[model samples]
Target: MTSTSGARSHTSPWELYDGLTALVPRGVTVTTCVVSRWALVETDAGGAGLSSVPDDGRDDPHGPQDVVGQDLADVAALVRSWDRRLAAIGLASINAWCNTQERLEAHAGDVIDWDASAFERSGELVQGRRVAVVGRFRHLDQLASRCDLTVLERRPQGRDLPDAAAEFVLPEVDHAFITSMTLANKTLPRLLELSGGARTTLVGPSTPLAPEAFAGRVDEISGSLVYDAPWCRRALMQGQGMASMRGALTLFNLRVPA
Candidate 1:
């Protein structure tokens, strides 16, 4: 159910999107669509996409107004859409798109449930080593004091380096963790290329659990799997952030095979 075998066929993340869209069940109805702090869609079968972000009027032709009431199966296909910002719909599709992987995780064979320690596990690989983080995650204090860490953020804050620093820092780092939001913003491929020398991990909510998307580019995928659909839906509708909805999600890690 993990699709690691099929992963070899997908050379890019967009190709993986096409593969996942093909798996979305026909006749599935989208019961609710909410766009506030996060874009979310709920299907009749308790499926919910956790990372969908609504397109604010700018470059996106299809906004939340265009997606509400549409069938879940149709919206799920937006993962392959041309408008990169339509990723709000595409990210939501992860719930419907990876039904098989979710089912497999539910049975508890290969998936590692990290609960609150997923970040800790990610840091373990970089302990006492030179590390570069693509995004400025809030838990930097948890890393080992001896570790050499350089943070790169799109919008530089405090001591964190700007995104431009990636060219100079990534190749020299021993480990790197790139935010999975790169998938939605369409930056994963270039980031992977830049961080080729480091042990790279894709981290965050928008990360598709699909191994096919990561394949040889990412060494690990640190992401959350929605466990309580109602809680997740309510959080999205109320504009409450993921940091406040810990009970609704289970953190999981997938190691891409060598």
Candidate 2:
């Protein structure tokens, strides 16, 4: 693990938004959570929306709720309205308890740029190509099924970063995806550095627009454009340890300048 010197501090949505407002980037949106709903902040552009998730009709500990699912339609609408230059959208739903990796793999042919079916179902190799993925969870084996793909896990603690940084020694790759939760641990910059020379993408809401931190480092960032609810955060905070929040937020994605 790599070590940084700083005390962990709790952040409110307002504070997080304020910090991001100071360094907005072109063609990017920052999404954070409100109460039971989500909010979108297009720093470079100007638009906002909400998301929907599947409902189990179960009462939430926080209170009664209408379980709206991920608004993929609305997301696509935003991209279209943005003139299609929106390269990618960052989502942080992983923290919201969404299992997006499986969703992505299930819809690989439709969602991913390449033929993810071979990778997901057969674990077949996409020959002569290299790929990078940050944030390790249950989907690693499926991702590793692609013989040509090299998976690098990024886990940043408050003080120490993951040892996976050394894997960046590989020459380069075709694509890269990062998780926004890296913001909570402040390891996005380091992960971007590791993706050097690759057509990199950051895939988490925690991604910040401090371009200088990733300039000459990565090529793109992708994640959810919104954050999770305060209730979700409170639930995680009230957990026995960090496990609950970790479990909830793993379902989404986001992106930033890498």
Q: List the residue pairs that clash in candidate 1.
A: none
Write model 2 residue lDDT over 1-258, tens digit each, in one string.
111211112233233323333332233433433223222222212222222221122223454222133333233222211111111222222222222243335433333332121124323333345665555434555555554555444444442235365364333555555554443333445554555545555543344323333333444333332233343446533533223333333222222222
Error of 2 at 119 (Å): 11
Misplaced by over 4 Å in model 1 are 1-13, 19-25, 52-62, 80-85, 99-101, 104-113
How high a TM-score does candidate 2 get? 0.39
lDDT tens digits, residue span 1-258, model 1: 112222233355566556556667677777776655555667777676666352322345444446656777788776555455456666676654453345536535445545544467755556688888888788887773647889999888988998888989987888778887666666666777777767777787766666654566667777776667778777766778877667877776766654
For all candidates in order, the CA lDDT equals: 0.66, 0.35
TM-score of each: 0.81, 0.39
Candidate RMSDs in order: 4.4, 14.0
